[model samples]
Target: MARMPSAERRRQLTEAAIRAMTRDGVPRTTTRSIAAEAGVSLSVFHYCFDSKQELLESVMTTITEHYVAVVRDAIRPRATVRETIRAGLQAYWDHVAAHPGEHMLTYELTQYALRQPGFGHLARRQYELYAEIYEALIEQLAAGMELDPSVKVPVLARYLAAMTDGLTLNFLVAGDAGAAADILDVIADHVADLFRADT
Candidate 1:
């Protein structure tokens, strides 16, 4: 068999690890299981990644990047800040509704990252990525609507990050999409009010 390039093999191992972790639970997943999932030898797994921890970090990155695309693509720019906020948030909720497993896996990995030694940084960086995505979305909305500079982009980004996290957890636990979405709609209005320069 022909040998796979480093990058391609790395991607394969990362994706295989994600599946193995998702199927077996992160704590129970083993390098052997991951190698089986990848159809690669144990040596290949070790060659592609230094350790299981490294492979898991890659899995976290992969999942994060996946949802970033989902959330970004769902949001539609609109005429007014209220419309924009509502559109973006509703689209976000819709994505969560459609991909509950993906969202659940992300939160699970976050908890795992938080508990592991030398891996807590992954959890922190996950939120940082969330904040960055939110900041970019806020800037995009600002192009069409005037934002209150005093409120600050980072502040609002963190606020949205927290709100979405809580709402997603709530929905996952209660399966109450209707209530969560309604509350999110209200939050969208309030957030728009806070940032709206016109009002």
Candidate 2:
């Protein structure tokens, strides 16, 4: 295969590691398997990442950025807060449906990081990242609508992050897009009511 730039090679290795972990689970994943998946040699993997943990950390960052971008792209400046909520939530669900394997791998990696030595911080950082993204989105939505939220942005951000995580886990296990859609409607309504400016 033709050689790739260092940045491209690093991204390839990170993506390959995600696929490898998803296919084989964290316990069975190895640098050899990740390199094979990336169509590169073990030495290339070592050149790209000093250790498996480092690779996993990069994978987490990559996935987080991808997920955030999906949601951000889905959101639009709607005339109504309810419409905005619905669009954002639907976009998120669509992303989940489109990339189930990657989402599953992300959850698995979270558990793996939590249980591994010197890696629990990664899991915490993951949630913090989510919260930050959610907070920013919420702020943007509020600004777009010229409204102020009843609750603080940080609290709302954490609540939405936790709610989305639970909703996603349920949808994944049940494979019930209909039920998830209904739940999203409820969430949208709540968000609309909670974030609307005082009458």
Identify the candidate with maximal TM-score: 2
- Model 1 over residues 1-60: C-alpha lDDT tens digits? 479899999998888877777677888888899889999899998888887567767887
- Point out where model 2 deviates above 4 Å: 146-149, 197-199
Local distance difference test scores for all models = 0.81, 0.84
lDDT for model 2 comes to 0.84
Give per-residue CA lDDT, model 2, range 1-199, as digits (tens): 7889988999999888888887888889888988999999999889988876788889888987877887787677777889888898888888888888888887998999999999998888888988999998887777645445357889889988988899988877989989989999999988887765534
- Each candidate structure's TM-score, on Cα atoms with residue i matched to residue i, is 0.86, 0.92
Clash count, one per candidate: 0, 0
Error of 1 at 190 (Å): 1.7
Highest lDDT: give the candidate number: 2
- The reply for model 1, stretches above 4 Å from the true place, is 1-5, 197-199
